[model samples]
Target: MATATGKNAKKTNKQTDTAGTKSSQKDGGSYQAKDIEVLEGLEAVRRRPAMYIGTTDARGLHHLLWEIVDNSVDEFLAGETDRINCTLHKDGSSITVSDNGRGIPVDKHPKTKKSALELILTTLHAGGKFSDKNYARSGGLHGVGSSVVNALSTEMIATVRRDGHEWMQSYKRGQPTAGVKQVRRIRGHGTTIFFRPDDSIFRRTKFNPETIRQHLEDISFIHGGLKIFFHDETKGETHELHHPEGIGAYLEKITTDGQKKSVHEIPFSTEKDDRGNRIEVVLHWTEATDEEVRSYVNGIRTHAGGTHESGLRTGVAKAVKNYMDVHDIKAKGVTVTNDDIREGIVTIISVFLGDPMFQGQTKEKLNNPELSGQVEGLIRPGWKRGSTPTRRLPTRSSAGSCSPPALAWPA
Candidate 1:
């Protein structure tokens, strides 16, 4: 470890050696070759980036953005940060992200012994999120976000302000190009990452402003007053996505009532026994063109609705039909498909937990098979117990599932 011009630099060197033994944990006992397993080097990420971040195209590139954004969001959940800034550089080959959050700890990780910052960047499947004590809720709890991004980037610069000083590190293709070094002393705290995607891994390195805008807008809705600043230097534009009313504002923007009667917004919230789990649900129906049900597990989007959503659908359909039965509204041949029950429904389900089991490379689905039933069990009862409002839901034109609208990027 090298010290620089900072008041805190004279303190004890918090750096540790990058040496450790591979061990397996079984029945709370540690063992060793049967225990020791290795993933070789950066080759796994290069060969299977999609299995980690979802796609190899523009969406995958955007997933890199999410990985970095997730760290900032983790800070928000940890109650240490509130504002985040994302800038697309003029060259189009790089992105610079800065967040006013509790910066990544610059201390040494006990296991790997290197500066935690360096270990997180150079190694795979390592970070502070593994244990619930480290974070109350996290999006990249699997610890693949930063490492995967580093592996796929041609270059990366990470800077952190903590303990009254600024520490910096850089990486080239997942390996450190320079050792961890302190640069300057700074007030307050934050982390900034500037990276250029590897042309060898990513077919293109250009940034998409509209895509970033939409994502920041969506995240702003979820986070409610959290400020997110967007700067497209390539396009010479800057904007902020912040909503005081939160999801309500998001729904109002996307929903328009046509022939449907004004129905009460059915609000439901429940916490599970899964130690540090929260599920918040808001649902309302309109005469809108489609059903928009977005599910999130610990801030990560579950685009391919998993079992949790399936349970939600089943609970909604059952509750509605039960209410219809109680009212003696004689209607024949009416069966509630997930589609039928959710028609014109604008709903957002947010689940926050320390650890999320996600499906596949892109993590498009929540993979905690048990949690699906857990959410259903917790939420279904709420719906069943709530008083069902009386209103004739207008017949809606069925517009199946939504796909990404036309967005311009490299082919």
Candidate 2:
């Protein structure tokens, strides 16, 4: 009888164990299609802000400025605007960017039935950039910059002066608090955006003035005639950056500040391709062994570099090699490489391409393969132009005299 009781107990324990296993699987392991959550509109941005703007840290904080400034830069590129103003509030809580470009459209959007300004600020992937009619080439081609900034901010206000009137709208965490309303009549045409980044969404909300100044200076240098002004209300200081010489001034500053020696006194070259793509390069060799190359496509800086940089490297190497060969100079053992030619070189390559292809959302690198061939073709002619067997190391004087080949526009 005791043996029989033991067997019954064992069966009950086995049943309890099975029941526990089933309960655990049901609670922890059950995943079905119903479990998938579909975030709509700006919700997706709020859900994964990092995917859009990179991070919620200092880098992302500064990206907000870049996005707003890029819109104004695009205006300058399109021959519409001449000035951009950026202001940081005293308490380090908000920033305001204003541009003299054509203000954002205030008319009702045909598709959304809302003011164009409202649609752009609240909806993801909505803007004038998608169409080439408004912009031939732009840094904010993705149309995500403003909206992403809006979604991540706790409060946003958009004010536009266009069509002889000033219009305004306000938003709270990506949702419109009110429709577009006329603020008053205005004399100028432009748009002003003010926003306070949500402290809850970001790691920190303090704005760095130095970082803002540096980036604004870079933009000013890239766009020759456009002026950028930065005012820090907190510190009661102001800075205005205008570079008429454009990238030439930029190169001068970098080389002078770093005290880098240049192989050429005037270190600048420019060429244009048939497709309206313009290439400008400024380079010099420094005493330091490090190599620095900064490249930009349209107005967007590509820190990672891409095919354009490769083309520049290839062209420089080929040019140097050809010069050596023509002079009967031979390397001792190993072949002279691009690395050898690029040692201690500081180069800035700026290309204006109609439609630039970038590798990722942040546009850290350019990936267009055609740009390589175009740049190579443009640079090779300058090197090969008056070469003879007796020519010595091509000096700055001789190199400058060689005019760039006639631009070949696409048929």
Q: Pick the candidate with the highest lDDT.
A: 2
- Tens-digit lDDT track of model 2 for 1-411: 344368798998899899998998888766777899998879998888889888899988888878888888998888899999999999887999999999999999887788999988988778887767988878887888899989999999999999999999999889999989998988999999999998988999999998898888887888889899999998999999999888878887887778777654545365675477788876656655667888988878898999999999887667666656665665434354567556667878899877788886778889888889888776666655532222112222322322111211121
- TM-score leader: 2
RMSD of each: 17.6, 6.0
Worst 10 residues of 1 by lDDT: 402-411
TM-score of each: 0.79, 0.87
Give a tens-digit lDDT track for model 1, residues 135-197.
Answer: 877887667788889999989999999899999999998888988898988898999998989
TM-score for predicted model 1 compared with the true structure: 0.79
Clashing pairs in 2: 274-409
Instruction: After superposing candidate 1 on the true structure, give the runs of residues whose Cα lies further than 4 Å from its correct spot.
Output: 1-39, 256-275, 332-338, 377-411
Model 1: lDDT of residue 235: 83
